[model samples]
Target: MRRALGVVALGVLVTGCVGPRPAAPVATAIVAPPAWRTALGPGSPVRAEWWNAFGDPVLTRLVAEALANNPDLGIAAGRVDEARAAERLARAQLSPTVSVGVPTTDSRALNAFGTASTNLTATPSITASYDPDLFGRLRNASAAARAQLLASEGARDVVRLAIASSVASGYITLRALDARLAVARDTLAARGDALRIARRRAETGYTSNLELHQAEGEYRATEQLIPQAQLAITRQEDALSLLLGATPRAIGRGAALTALVLPPIPDGLPADLLRRRPDLFQAEQTLVAADRSLDSARAALLPNIALTGSAGVILTTALANPVGIFSLGGSVLSPLFDGGRLRANVDLTVARRDQAAFSYRRSALTAFREVDDSLAGVQRSGEQAVAIRGQRDAYAAALRNASNRYRAGYSSYLDQLDTQRGLLTAELALVQANADRLTSYVALYQAMGGGWTEADVAAVRR
Candidate 1:
């Protein structure tokens, strides 16, 4: 009969220990992402690694190195590990906890007739305990943790985008500053030549001292601008080096800013952003996590059913008296009058879930706006650059004509100075416009989600 009871108990335990998996939840829709601008040229979807459009091998190598070697990326990887660990911990709760042991005991006893007796005994047995999870408590907790793991993965991807974009932006700015420095030095040289010509002409009584002094002053002013521009370039270079996780070195990537070609903006379907951008994906994961938490909180209100059994020998080994015993049992707990605490917890979780839903909506809208803004930036910047191109050509021709006339004694040195300055100014503006155009394309690429891949997502999940 005892053996039959044991078998029935084992069967009952096995049948009772099962968990339910819940379906994943999706959040409400926000504004759709803006379609990419393709008016610049006919194009397919642009590749997300848009920095490669710069077509510089050095820039590619530098970006790859920074992405690989960055310490902050390592920190993000650690967070992935932490989330995965939490997921494992949550899953572990679904399994029963089992333990086994044998115990021995001895005691001396005196009879009424002054006789003493003692015996030592050991009983080996197995014990187990489990929370059946019939109300989905454990399952909901595990689901919550799994959602957090995915959320952390998305967060890591976000961090990766941030690092890559920062490095690219810094490099682009550094190159722009380098171009500005070159223009400043060339302007200074032209002004110095003008000063020399004026001084020589004045020495021969061909020009006035006033003209000579004016030329010298213009030359000195241009020379001063050179150092200021060079200082800016140095600071930017140092900053970019730091972004690449390095001490400042002689980081001279001499690709002219004008040489960088802006790839045509892509025209992706607006609905595709639901899977493309990491921030949006992260927001979705956050909402899922909050939903799981609500389930967990609600489950807490239900009566908890637990089975705990132990079969370990308890030995009392006092010198005068020793004893040993074995026992097995279980406990069950139900929420009986918790002063509305369980309801309050459930309400709080629902509120937090609503908060996550709102956050997701905000992120989706922001992503759409970014795509729109970058699209406009690309088209408008290019148009503005086209207008400047004409101005630049006209200024170049005027500078040349003024130089020739000054040498031929037909135009004043001031005319030459002014025209040359005008030409340099136009050239600088054109370089800046070109850089801005490229940066706008980069922004669009990032808005479309860069660097994240299926493999990257898988790796983070692992």
Candidate 2:
């Protein structure tokens, strides 16, 4: 009857050891529009070399260089490695651990026959211990670690996309600044010619001293712009140099903004963004980790079954005898009470998992917003650039007509001054508009997660 009661108790304990497993977290489906409202180019598959869409070899080179050398990218890659190592460690926990120890002892003692004896004994033993994952604790912990590694990989790709876009955008800005500087220098030359013409007209009685003074003032004003434009060019160059991990210095020139070709706008489905955007993917991985953590926490509340065993040979010199020893045992530990700490851990993980779900939802919405914003920016900026180019051309013609009319005494010097200022303003605006359009394209590519791939991630790890 006592044996029967013990058997019943053991059966109850084993039943409790199974506990309850946490269910996987389910993600809510988010609906996206079938098509973008913005008038962007047709959507297409992502290219691995998205920067090459600009058709600027210089930009392509710069982006590649930044990917290979940017310090922020390196840091992200390091984090990926760290996460991978953590995953490996978690996996190792699922396997049993075996260790060998060799112990030697020298002693002076009396033997069984009452004779004094010096004896040396050496015993080498191998021991192994394994904790069975009775409630899937090891499995849950490993899954959580793997999700963390995936999140790290996604983070690294996020950094890669940012660095590539930034490098391309910086290069575009530098080139635009160079174009503006050229415009400033050219305007200064034109102003000098106008001043010379005014002086000649004044000497010949074709114009008054007031007009000559106005021309001189215009020339000095245009001259001041040259230094400012040069300063901007220097500043842009410095920014690009840092992206390349190089000393602050001049960068190689790329094709003019007008010479670069724009790729067709991709009209990718909104739902596709979940697959393309690294940040969203990272958030999802974080959610997975949270879910797994909750499972591991729940599993921790159950009893753990562990098996320990050892085997070795012992030699006694005094007795001239060799003896073998072996033992095997199993133990079960169930958490009876810990002042509610176990339940608190469960609550903590549940709260964390809920937070992760909210974070994942927020990230998805943010991704959608970014894609929409980039699409609008690209479309509107492209339209603005075209309109600004036409305006610049019209202003240039007006400047010429004003100069001609002044030469013929048909218009006042004030008219010529106003046209010259308008032409300068229009030219500068056109340059800026073009650069903005190009940068908008870069932004769109980045918002779409560029051309990052698992292969690229593997390369980064290496």
TM-score of every model? Answer: 0.81, 0.84
Q: What are the Cα lDDT values of the candidates? A: 0.72, 0.77
Q: Which clashing pairs does model 2 show?
A: 41-265, 42-266, 42-267, 43-266, 43-267
269-327 per-residue lDDT for model 2 (tens digits): 33443355777778889999999999999999999999999999887686667888888
Local accuracy of candidate 1 as per-residue lDDT tens digits, 312-356 = 543343333434445566666888898999999999999999999
Clashing pairs for predicted structure model 1, backbone only: none
Q: What are the RMSD figures for all models against the true structure?
A: 17.4, 17.8
Instruction: Highest TM-score: give the candidate number.
Output: 2
